[model samples]
Structure formats: structure tokens, C-alpha cells
Target chain A: MFDYLQYVRQENFPHIWCAGCGDGIVLKALIRTMDKLGLSQDETVMVSGIGCSSRTPGYVDINTLHTTHGRAIAFATGVKIANPDLNVIVVTGDGDATAIGGNHFIHAARRNIDLTVLLYNNYIYGMTGGQCSPTTPRGANASTAQHGNLEPAFNISGLAIAAGASFVARGDAYHVKKLETLIGKALQKKGFSLVEVVSPCPTAFGRRNKMASPVKMMEQLRDTVVSVEKWEKMTGEERKGRFRTGILRDIEKPEFTAEYAKLIEKMRPEE
Target chain B: MSNDRPGKVRMMQGNQACAEGAIAAGCRFFAGYPITPSSEIAENLSVMLPRLGGKFIQMEDEMAAMGAIIGAALTGQKSLTATSGPGFSLKQETKGYASMAEVPCVIVNVMRGGPSTGMPTLPAQMDVQQARWGAHGDRGVIALTAKSAQETYEQTIRAFNLAERYMTPVILLIDEITGHTTEKVIIPDASDIEIVHRKKPDKDPENYLPYRFTDDCIPTLAPFGTGYRYNVTGLCHNETGFPTNDSNEIQCLIERLTRKIEIYEDDIIRNNELMLEDAEIGVFAYGSVARTAQAAVRICREEGIKAGLLEPTVLWPFPTKAVLAMAQKVRAIVVPELNLGQMAREVSLASQCSVPVHKLGRVDGSPIPPQQLVEKIREVV
Candidate 1:
């Protein structure tokens, strides 16, 4: 048995995350997934940007890099290339990946770098006191927008798939088993992979939206998420209040690392 | 500073000589984009590194080139990147990253003219200020200037050692003239010289902090992939190398980074005085400009104007003390630069004497003629 208790630093636990906080749930799902996949402590590396979710690296037993806000992918790309054998994983929040780090995330996906990116979509900037993030749902109330957000949230799974990620999936941190499986799939993918874990932000996002508790947020997630095939079958009116769940896209392509190595070998026959 | 290769004397441009210097310094990884007078460094490195079981990459741009060098260096290899003007401008962010993260790498800039694309093949020293302040944020940079093809080799080795010793990036500043002008350089065997390696952490992997600093302020460098679990970041960090927004932590980090270099200023500076003992007039210059100043001093002396040249081989640290001490004795100071007047400003600032300072120059592709420099010296005399 790969013990979760053994892998985590006990003193840091009962983490600062609020009750029903999707970040806590996502962390649990990730831990379970890594254990299930049989990735040992030493072979793995976790990297993160600045956010409530980015604190994921601090508690993990594996090698970790806690970098500048929004540049986790860039640093992870460097780490992966420097040692191609290490299993690289990125933990970021919605604001961390899609806003400031959007350029790096898109380029890394398009280039098909072999790495897993777990974007916790809590729909608001939690650690920085709930400014509007890139994925704040339409009309969501945030500190920056007391009048409610006017911007449309990104379909993160769709964005990653369109940007040429080899595997893309969506999961709600409320769905424990599903979240774990999605993470496992991303870890096993040969190229860029993103698992958008739609997490609950009860402290800032939920309380303001009248979904004040984890129970209420989980109920909303359960009601709003529709499978992609069912989403297609649903009427336009039905689609307006819901978000799509399950695998949005999965592709097969040569990863960034292997392809670069191939080019090097071709030019240098002696190698 | 090893003479790993024996009995090799070649007539090579200063830029190519620097490439050979990098090779002799144990640089096995080079990633750079070709630009201006610095193109020869990348071209030579591309030809040489592959033969030594190392990798050489021609990156798409200078930003990536800098990132590549840092990534390569993290693997315990000596790495370098070369660029000029526009390309050098693109590398500032990563250079700051190298500074904050304390990566040991060599950056060679063969400066050309202008704000942007001023003189592609011509010489300029406009980047003297940029060498000190180019990278964003508060940090210390190790800048070394080379005056000849011979010093180009020696300075290249010194750059790596200082970088290793201090755990920071060292900029080798060479103008286009020194980069392109041919000179006689002798290469000795690797066994003949001492090479410095950064002290690594002795603690267990779990206990190692990436940015751990000693009382001397130098951090132990643990080359990546040694199973050491330490993080490196570009953000202002505490001694552990993880990003921190605390004001005190930020202050401590910047203070320590700069103090590490400023404290070692004496050991980091290099310069020379040519016939200063009996001279009444002085010429202050650096890099390739110093070479022409030496010639000008000789020409002025023959014309009955007693003068000497002060050559600054280690530019930033500036050798200001030497200039200030010599300033009180000389009646006049002459500065000749490839740019309009970069180093002349420093000479004027450091001189305590009320000496009349004059500049002999060119922003064009040509060096300041010896006759013109001699005339400038005579006028000041």
C-alpha cells in the first residue's frame, strides 16, 4: 500500500483551506491518483505557481518547485528537459494557468511537452482575496466586480484540446473517484495533458453566490455538470445553466522531448 | 583555468579566442543566436562543443538561448550564450533569472552601436550601463572586459571561475573591434592551470535549501539531478529559493546578492598602467578602446607629450580607485571609445584632479586612428 499518511507532512495538515474548499478535495484526489498510478516518491516532481492551490508542492514528499506566479509551466518545462526521465506534474489554479500564465500554458500544450497540468478551477482568485479570475462564471460576484463579472469563463478543457494537448479531461473535486481517474489518465498521456478540476471556493466564491457551504457547492456541481454527449443532446436553454464534464478531448501525438531528441539524432549520425 | 589542451598557438580574432577560452574553461553546453560581431563566438562554439561530447543549440531567439544555457548548466555542465545589441536586450529577463537563482554560466556580449540595430558590424560600448542595470530588479552582475585576444582567453576562464565562486552569471563584455580583430594567442594544456568549482551542499537531500547562504554570502550550488530536492526561482526569495512576498525577505535577498559581489570588489577588479610612472598626461579606456589608447599613448610620448594609458580589463567594478589615485597626478585625461563617450563619463566622475578630459572617437565601423588619439592627447597636454 502506498500510504497517503506517509507521503504528507503531518504538521502542515488540516490545511488552511476552508471546509468544503475544492482545493483540499483536489489535493486529496491528486494524492490518491499518484498512489494508484504507482509513482514513487523519488521519481516524481511537482511544480506550482502562486495561488491557494499552488501550495500543493509544499506538503508533497516528492521533489517540488514553488515558483513565481503564473510561470509554473515554464519552470516545469525546464525541469523536464533537464532530466527527461523524471515524471513532471504541475499544480495551478484557474487564475494561475489561464490568466498570467496563459501564454506559457498554450505554447507548452501546442509544442506537446510531456507533462501533466492540473488546473483547479475554483472560478476566483482565492489566495489573493477573490479578485475576478479568468474562469469566473458570467455574472459571478467578486471583489473586483461588485456589479458581477461581465467576462465569459474559459472552457478550459476545450482550450487545452484546441491548443493541441494530447489528453484533456474535466472533473469536479466533489467527485472523488472520477477526479482520481482523470488525474491518472493525464499522468499516463504521452504529451501535454490537462485535468481541469472544477473545485469549490466556499470562502470567496460560494458564500458570495449564496452557495455558502461545501454541501451546497457539491450539490450545484452535481446538478450543473452534464456529460459531453448529453450536452450535445440537451437543448440550448438546458445548456445555458450547465458546464460539460468528462473527457473533452484526447489526442495521440509525438511528445516535445522525444521529437527533439529524434531531430538531434538525425543531424548527428555519430550519436 | 586549466590548460587541458597543450601547445596550441593560433592567430584568431578576439571573439574566436573567447570561444577557445570557453572550451578551455570546460564549457560543454552552448545555446545562442547569431548577432553582429558576436556571431563568431556561437559559430566557433557550435563547431567545437559537438566534438567534445557536449550539445550546441542554435536557438530561435536570445531569450530561449539564455533559458537553454541555464537549463544546460543546471546539469553540472559549464554553459554559455553570446549575442549583441538587440539579441542582448532579449536576454535580460533570463539573465535576471540566472542572477536570482545563482546559476553559473557565461554570457558574452560583443557590443555594437545604437539603441537598436545601430551598427551591426561596427563597435560600440553603449552597454556599459546596461551591463550593470540591464536585468530587471535589484541584483549584482559580474562584468569582465577583454582588451586583447590573449586576455580574451584569460578573462573567459576568470568569468567562469568568478561565476562558480560566487554562483552567479558573469558577463564578458567585448566590443566588436576586439571580437573581430586578429591577434596572436597561445593555448596551454589543461593540467597547467587551476579550475574552480562551486562548493556544493554536504547536507542530505531532504535538508538542502537551494538558496542557502553562508556568512560570506555565497550559496552552495547543487547541480540539478543530483537527487537534491531544492527549488530555484526568479522571484524574490528567502534563502530557500522559493518565492516570497514578504518585504523583509525581499530586502534580505537583494542585499545578500549585491553584497556578495560588492564585498569582493578587490578580488573581482583587473587593470593595468602602461608607462604611468613618468607620465604627466593619462588616457583612461577599456576593452578594445584601451588597445587604441595604448597606441595613442606611445604616439604621444614620441611627439614630446608625456602620457600613459590606464587599461581597465575588468570593466564594471570599473577600476575607479586606480583611476582616482592616478587622476591627481596627470595634468590631463584622454578617453577614446568606439561609442561616442561611454567610458569617458566614468573617467571624469572618478578623477579628483581638475584635468582637461578629451574624447577621440567613432560611432562608425572604424577604430579611432592612432594619429587622431595622439593629437587629442597632445591638445589636452
Candidate 2:
């Protein structure tokens, strides 16, 4: 235990975030990663859009901005360009990043701005009660989907890898150490990095659907998610109904903030 | 300035003057979408602002355009964005959020021809009503009009002051013609201007409440990461700024949002009076269109017609006192806008005893010329 308590609100220890809420686990992982990297608390900025998981920044005691829903990346873009010195991270939920903010997320990744996007995927809209989010399972019992959800879920890691994200990884909150390693790796990677954490939302997605409790949710995640290398060796039937997880891609183009700072240095040069 | 007490003289277009005004008012961040007439403001800002170590970002959409400015402003950057008519329409929702959250920002809407994507490259005044009612609610907007390139400069400076002082989004209404029609302007050294900064919390981060109001009902704003642990939501928020759908909170917020503007009528609104000292008929106009009215006034004067020009620098507090004062002296008001009759209606509403408020506008991508304005002025006079 690397004293992850520094990044948590212990008074909010039994947080409104219920048991089996992977948000806490992912948040803990993020804190551990920050600690491992020894990132300066003074120079770190964490921004988030609206959602249950977007609330992570407020607990960390860093420079945090709880911005408008679906516009965390855009706000982070401004923050990065403004300072260019601070380590800017956008903490967004599945719906916040993938749905309403889809355009901004793609464009930011495409620009390869030195932004780290931590996307928490709990598979359902957790904040305003359980609603059908963009990442909800194809057939799930959500508020909007009485019978079942009809739309196919978005493969977020695949989308990030495709949209020119320099580093893309997927991990479940159940594997805290491995997840924290991925987060630290993503943070240290020299370009736009995304770590999609498939967390469990017991209150909304679990309780309503009679899914696993906290411990059993971790067990289900451990049982269901297979690493990409192992899944590549698995047969088609073995991979059915399973969302593969691992470091999907890691290749650099150009880092956004440094390049911009370079251009500014070269072009303007203090007049 | 009817008082003819010349303060500062600068040769600038209505649009370029707007950028200078924003700069003079200490705006450090500008994010905008390129549209006709308003592009110069963005262009000048991009060229000049960075020279002063200010930041400029060209956003992807008008929605993001406004959002970037609002965000930067919340970061304690005096920020602004300029766009034309269609882009102005796109910014309405965000502008509404700025009003509700009282995020101080100056938005320049260079009026262009359209109801749809009608005129991307032309000028219009139809956006007058849109500037007021464009956002969803009954929230009051502080708008200013520019006649000369010089007035555009001065009013744009005023727009920022009013915005920061009042903690609201102030709109600088310029027409496409004024935006494009350039004039020579001397960029004064930075020392010659009075700039007002948006007031922020003096209390330590631990004791700050983001939207706590002072006696003026105008509260100080705290930038993000400034240690103010408060939320700014589009929903009706109490002083602490958490979303409260409660009716009492809702009414108090809306009333303060509206009255903070409406109550400061004398201080917040601005316009001009030209030869109205002895005239019986007035030519009311704004932006570049007001120039034609100014020329028309001179023409009417040469022909011995009693005509004057009321160029409103502030649009939404609607310059009612000017209209009422002129209404007592003049039998009719000839309002020439670039669009169909938006500001003319406000003139009618503000008029006393059914004074004839006639509108002469051109929405077909052409300016209402001075001769045409002169004819309207003579007929009304």
C-alpha cells in the first residue's frame, strides 16, 4: 500500500460510490501511478466532464476543474495551451468522452496534444441513474432500455488506437497493480495516451441487473477479460461475448504540446 | 460623442477596433471561428494578442469557439470570441450558460445576412433580436453597436468592461459592412487606456464560495484551480453554485441574472446623440449601417431638414432613454438596419405615444447607402 489515501477523501471513504464501484479502484490506481512517477503535485492539472467517475479530480487535491459535460478534453486543450508546462489529464466517463464529446476526443487525439485521457468504462451511464450509455452492452437492462439495449457498444480502445492515439491500453479495475502500471506507463508515454479502465458500477449496472458484488465483480472481470496476446491465440468461440483487454498499441507520432512549444520558440523567440 | 469631448482618436474599422478594444480591456485569450466581417477581429487579435503574450486559439466550431473563451475566462483569462450571424446563432446555448453562470466574456457578433446559411459573406442587422432573445431564456444581454470604426473600438472596450464588471457575456453587434470596411487606426501604447479586470475572491481558497454575491448582486468570479471549490452549472445555481432545481433558488438566480442587467440601466447602456440638440426627426441606426445614417443626417442638414443620428453603442438595455428623449423632439424615427427590422421593433417598443418607427433595411447582401438613408430621413423628418 503506497499510501493511496493521500489521493482519496477518506471522510468520503464510504463514498456515495457504492460497493463494486470500480471508480474507486481506478481512482486508487491513478493515485498509485502518480506516486510511482513522482509527478509534481504543483504542476499537475486534472480536468473532468460530468459523470460519476468524472468526480475523481475533486478528491486528488491537485489543480482540478470539473468542467461542463462532454467538454473536458476541449477545456484541457485550453489549459494545456495556456500553461504548456503543467501535466494535463482529462478524466472522463464513457458517455462523457465517447458520446457527446466524441468529436473533441477524436480531434484532440488526432492532434496528438500532450493530453492523457483516463476513460472510466463502467458500461452504463452511472450518474443520473442507470441510463443507456454509448458503451452499454448490446443487450442490457438500462433505464432507457426496458426490454434491452439494442445498439452495439463502442470499442473505445480500438477507437483510440485507430484515431491516432500514440499509446492505447485497456485494463479492468480488478487488477489494481497491473492497472496502475498501465496508467503510469500511459502518463510517461511522450504523446497522447489513453488508458480505458473497465470498472464495475455495482449500484447502477450491478444491483439493478443483479450482477456481482464488489468481490465477485472483480472475480467476473478477472474471469472474463483475457489479455490480447492470449486472446489472439484463443479460438473464435472462446472470444465470443468478450471484450479483450491489454496494451492494444504504443507508437509515437509527434507530441502536441512540445511541438507547439517548439514552434513558438522558433517562430516568436521573445520578439 | 455629442459632448464633442474627444477622448482618444484611432483610425480602425468597426471590427479591428473591436479587437483593439478587447486588447485594451485586457483580454488575453481569443478563440473564434472565421466568418465574414468578423474575421478581421480574429485576424488582428491573432496577430497582435500573441505579441503581448496573450493566447489565441481558433476553435473547431462556434460552440467550441464560445466554450473555449468561457473556459479561459474561468481560468482568469479575460477572454473573447468574434463570429458572424450563423456562428452567433450557434453560440447562443453557450452564451446562455455564460449568462446563467455569470462567466464574464465578451462576444462580438458581426451581423451578417441570413435566416439560414443565407449569407456567409454578406452583412445584415437581423441579428438584433437574435442577440437579445437568441439564447433560450429571458436573460438580459448587454449589447453595443458601432457606427464608425472608432466607435467600434471604443464600444468593444466598453463591452469587456461591462462584461467583467457585471459578470455577463456582452455582445458587440457589428454588421458585415463595418467589419470589412477598414479605416486607418493608430494603435495607442498600452498605457493610455483604463482596463477593468473581472473581480475575483479575495478570501483564501479555503473560505471561497464561487458565486457569492456582494451588495451589488454582482459577485466575484474565481478561476478554476484558484482553490475555489464551487461548481458552475447551466442549471439554476445558488451562491454556492451547486445545481438546485429549487424554485426559490431558481427565481433568485434568474431575477439576479436579469436585474443585475436591468437595474443598472443608466450605468450599463451607451449610445450617441448627434445634432439631436435641435432636430425634430431622428435617424436611429447601429454598426456600419449607422454610418449611412450619419451621412444621411449631413445630407438632410444640407437640405435644411431637422435630422439627427442616435448610434447606440449598447444594444440590449436598448438605449431606451435616447429613444424616448428623441421621441419627444422628433415626430418620427427612421431606423436603417442591414437586416429585416429587428432593432426597428425595439425602437417601436421604446417609442412614446406611437411615434412612427419606420424601418429601411437590406438583407440581400448589400448596404443601405447614405442616399437611401437620406431619403428615409427626409421623409420622416
Candidate 3:
């Protein structure tokens, strides 16, 4: 077993995630990835917005900033630009990153700033007691959507790709090792990178749907996710309910901070 | 960047002077969205910051601009953002976070007539009350005002200094007239000015407590990438910088937010009272309107109306002591501002209604002329 305990704040545990919540699985994967990369605790900063997933930073023993609702990406952008040497990771949720924070989400990707975004898509506002979120599927029951959600769910990976992120990937809690590999690849990417983890929020999201049991939700995620190659080969009708769970987009781009540093050097007066 | 050019005189706009002042005050990061009457500050910094290896980012929106600066400030970078009335309203929530988290950053609000973008290109002092109570909180805020391009430059530096000294967001409020006004500014030598930096922790990383109480009630901050790794949150946190639901801990955190600045009120509050030693009438004014009020007082004095002027550069914590002192020296107080009567109400309340406070306001997108202030003063007499 990996010594993930060495990277966490022992006093803050036992963790806040409920029994069978997939957030813990994702947290463990993040820790394991950090350990694998040998990231220095002192030089890494974890920023989060308001959500159950945003609470991830509080348990980590690193420079963490728990900011206002839906502003984590904006804050993380500043941290990255201010000190490009530091590794910046933004931990946010579906509602936080897509609903109230939609503008910042697309803009940060557009800037292609070097920020690793671990956006936990639980499909509902878990912290706010199961309100309908941007990722809440149509016909899904939520506290706010008691009559079934009328809005269409957002394609989290597609949105990042369209917004010009250098790397975009989708992973789920059921596939823990694969999720760890995706996160490690994102951390290594040069520009804006996003790993949308489809973690289960059983307490808030699952109890309303037919998958009230955490095991059932985990099984549903396992059954629905297909590899990118498998997804591409599927017919349009066959792909209706299934989603791809691998690197969706990857390319090279000039990162914002490096370009800014170059601009400074060029503009600096000669000694 | 060596400040070898001492007393170098230049004709500059208030917004440009504000940008120069930020550079002089060691502000290395600026994040702002363009809004009229304040965009010059952003434009000037974009051209200047790169030359000095400082960072300037035009954020996507007003709230992002505010959030970015707070984020930069946390990493031990002196940060600033400029906006107008509508943008200022958008920044309130994040501004409150800066207050609660005690992140040191400067926000410059160049006043424009507004209830919501009322007049983008025109001057109005309507946001005076918003500067003090815009955010939902009980924390103490430091807000300052300037009446001229030269004063705006000096006060911009003061805003940064105060933000650093107390580790709180300092708002510098100027109006469209002052922001666009052109005046001569003498750039001071770097050695001639005092620069205050945020106090960094000297203890070992293991024992570092981000919000531990000190003798002055101000906490020393460690840069994010440094050895000291701590958490900062908007929640009512304990000294260890983690959320606490304990009643005593919550109360202490809430009280300390205000107490830290209130205890140093003497060092923070600044005002200028002229010819009020024996005058029977006094005019209380600030920002661009103060210039007209000063002229009005001089005219009234020449006309033998016994009028004086009280101009406050620091607007919040309400300058109670100075208002009370001025009330004793005058029978009536005249306040002429671009808004209807924001600061006049503060003067009236601070004076305990000892003197009848008159308000001379104009929000028709034009500044109150000196003659109009003189008329208000004469009417009060």
C-alpha cells in the first residue's frame, strides 16, 4: 500500500466524505499521483471553490486557498501567473466550474495558462443539497429538479477542447488507476489541462435517482464509460448513453506565463 | 528599476499618475477589466509593468479581476485592480473575501454616476457609501479619496502602504474629473519614499500559524510557494487557519477582523482642516468636489462669511474625531459632493447633529462648480 497518509493533514481526518462517496477514491488517486510525481509540498498550491469536492484542499498539507464560490479558476490563474515556478492545481465541482463559474472556466482555458484543473463532476450541487447543476442530466431528479431536470447536461470535455485547453481528459472513480494516470498526464502538460473526474455524490445526487446505493452508482459509471477508441467505433445510436473515458484532446500551445516572461525580457531596458 | 530621477516633474493624468504610483509603491501584479474613467490605469500599467518585469493581466470580468489580485497578493505579490462604479459593484463579493481572509491588495474605484452604469463617462461620488459598506460584512475597511492628479498619485501609494501595513484591501476612490484631470506630478526618488512590505513569518515551517494573534492583532503571511504551507479560507477560521464552529473561536475571528484596523485608527485616519480655527461655517468635502469646496471657502472668507473647509483624504472609519472637532469650531457644516449626500450623512452622524449639515450635490454628469458650493455655504449662514 502507498503511504498516502504522509501527504495529508492527519488532524483533519477522518475525512468529510460520506460512506461510499467516490470523492475519497478520487482524493486517494490525486495523492498517489502527487507521490508518483514527487511534487514538493512546499512548491505546490491547491486552490478550491465552494463545494464538497472543493474541500479536497483542506485535507492536503500544501499551500491551499479555499476561495469564494465559482472563483477558483480565476484565483488559480493569478497564482500561476504570479509565480510560474509553482505547480498550481484547481479543485472544483460541476456547479462551481460550469454554472456560476462558466465564464472563468472558458477564459482560463482560452488563456492556456499552466493550471491543472481537477474538476469533480458529480452532476449535482452536492454541497448545496442536490440542486440542479450544469452537468445534471436531463430527466435527472434533484432537490431543485423534483419534476426532473429540464436542462441538457454539458459535455465537460468538449467544452474544454472548444475553449482551447492544451489537454482535456475524462475519468471516473470506478477506474481508479486510469484516473491516476490521466491526472499525472495533466500535471505534466505545459498549458491549461483539465481532468474531469466523474465521481459519485451518492448522498446528494444518487439518493434522488434510481441508483440510491453507492455501489449501484459506481457500477453505472463502470458500465457507461468507454475508451476513446471504443467510443469512436460505436454507432451514433450506440453512443447515446455512453461517454468516453480517456484523453479527449492533447496538443502543444504556448503557455501564458512563459509568453508573459518572454514579453518582459524583450521589453526590459538594457543594463 | 532604480528611482534615480528624484523630483522629476511631468504633466500627467490622474489615472496615469495612479499607475505610476503603483509602480513606485512596488505593486508588481495588476489584474483589471476595462471600465470607463478607470481604464487608463489598466492601459498605462499594461505598457509599464512589462518593462519592469511586473505582471499585468486583463481578466475576463470584474469579479475575476478582484479574485486574481487577491490570488496574487497571497503569493507575496503586491497587487492592484481598477474599476468604475458598475464594475466595483460586481467586485463586492470577492472584496469581502479579501477582507475576511486578510489578503493585502489595492482596489481603485474611479467614480462614475451610477445606480447601475448610470453614466460611464461622467463623474459622480455616489459610490462613497458603497466603498464602506459594499460588501456584506462587519470587518473594518480602509478607503481613501483624492482631489487632483498629484493627490491621486500620492494617495495611490498611500493605498498600497495601508493595504500592506494592515493586510487589508485599501480602496482609492476618485471621480471622473479627478481621474481624467491633467496636472503636474513630481516623481519622488525611491529612497525618498517609504515602502511597507507584508511581514513574513520567521518561525520554522512546522510551527507556522497563518492567522495566529500577535501584539498588533495583524498576522504575518508566508508566500504560497515558500516553505510555510498553510490554508486560507473565507470561512470563520481559527488561528491555525482551519474552519472552526466553536463559538469562542468564531467570535474571536470576526472581532479580530475589525479590531486589527480599529486599534490602529490613529495611524490610518487622515484629514486636512484649513482656516477653521475661528470660522463660523465649515464645508466637509472629499474627492474632486473638495477642490471646488476649497475654492468656495476662500471665496466665502473674502466675502466675510467666515467659512472654512475640511477635506478628508481617508474617508472610512468615518473621521469622527475630526468632524466633531470641526463641529465645535463652526455653526453649520456644508458638504458639496458629486452625489446627493453620502459623506454629509456621515458628517451629520459623526457630529451628533451638533451643527446643521447642508448638502450641495450634483449628479447631472457635471462637477459642482466653486460658485455652487459658495452658494450652499451662504445659504447655510
Chain B TM, every candidate: 0.94, 0.93, 0.98
**Model 2 steric clash pairs:** B11-B184, B11-B185, B125-B339, B143-B315, B144-B313, B145-B313, B280-B330
TM-score of chain A of each: 0.95, 0.94, 0.98
DockQ of each: 0.25, 0.32, 0.91
What is the fraction of true interface contacts found in candidate 3?
0.88
- What tens-digit string does per-residue lDDT give for candidate 2 at B1-381? 422533555566677778877888888889888887688888998888666777887877777778778767777788899998889998888788788878888898887778878888787787888888888886878988876676677677888888888899998888777777677555555676667887868898767667776678887877665555455557676776655658987888888888998889998776767788888788888777777777888888999998888888778888888888888878788888876788888888888556898889777888888998887776665
**Cα lDDT tens digits for candidate 1, B1-381:** 223446677899998999998988888778787788899998888777656655666654576677667765666678888999888887887788888888899999988887887889888888888888888888887899987888888899889888889889999998888898897887877886558888878898878777776788988857655677555556677776655779988888889888998889899987788998877988888887777778888877787888998887787767778888778788888888877777777788888546767776677767777787887776776
Candidate order by decreasing DockQ? 3, 2, 1
Best of the two (1, 3) by TM-score: 3
Q: Which portions of model 3 show Cα errors greater than 4 Å?
A: B1-6
Ten contiguous residues minimizing lDDT sum, candidate 3 chain B = B1-10
Write the number of the candidate with greater DockQ, choosing between 1 and 3. 3
- A35 Cα displacement, candidate 1 (Å): 2.8
lDDT of 1 at A120: 92
**Model 1 DockQ, alpha carbons vs. true complex:** 0.25
RMSD (Cα, Å) for all candidates, in order, is 4.1, 3.5, 2.0
Residues A1-271, model 1: lDDT tens digits: 5477856756446576777788877887888888878886766778787888898777776766666667677666766665667788999989989998787688778878899999999999998888999899889899997899999988787788888898999988767787788899999988999999999998888888898787899999989988788988989999988888777878788997787566556556463
Clashes of 2: 7
